[model samples]
Target: MAAVPLRRPLDAETVVVPVGQVFVIPERCKGCRFCIEFCPEQVLVESDRMNAKGYRYPVVADGKERACVNCGFCRLICPEFAIYTEEIR
Candidate 1:
């Protein structure tokens, strides 16, 4: 018997990765990890600096400036509304 592939490769022309910039209100963040934990792109991480409330907020991980896809998943999931994205263009 021959093995069957589960999927075929997509053609190069059809692939378009979205990009955006991520923003955060450090003071509005309460150290909750929802945005960081649930980001589909996994583009965020806890920063070394703490806000006035002593809560570590999310920042774009090093070398990940172009990694955000502008999906708004972080904005949708953030209870504190501290995280959002805007199209790069």
Candidate 2:
């Protein structure tokens, strides 16, 4: 009789992300809100009005540090790619 192959179960673990931060460039930002919606932490929010180009720009609102996880979700999702992250030294 042929021996049966054994299968191993995958282990579940939480992803540990490094302490990262993001910055929004007013000049580069087109205020598309792509970062605001895409950000998992909801760190970015729409300001009172739009930018010079008539677009809603994103700004860090509420929690200053805890809010933004620096996942770079907004940066990637943004069509303009205006979102940028900075590492704390």
Q: Per-residue alpha-carbon lDDT of model 2 for 23-82, expressed as tens digits? A: 776766776677777677778788777677777778778676655656667777877767
Mark the 10 consecutive residues where model 2 has the least summed lDDT: 8-17
> After aligning candidate 1 to the native by TM-score, how far in Å is the CA of 49 from where it should be?
0.4
How high is the lDDT of residue 2 in model 2?
92
Candidates in order, TM-scores: namely: 0.84, 0.64
TM-score of 2: 0.64
Q: Give the TM-score comparing model 1 with the true structure, all chains together.
A: 0.84
**lDDT tens readout by residue for model 1, 1-89:** 89887785677578677799998989999988998888888899999999999999999999988999899999898999898999884
Candidate 2, residue 54: how far the Cα is off, in Å: 2.3
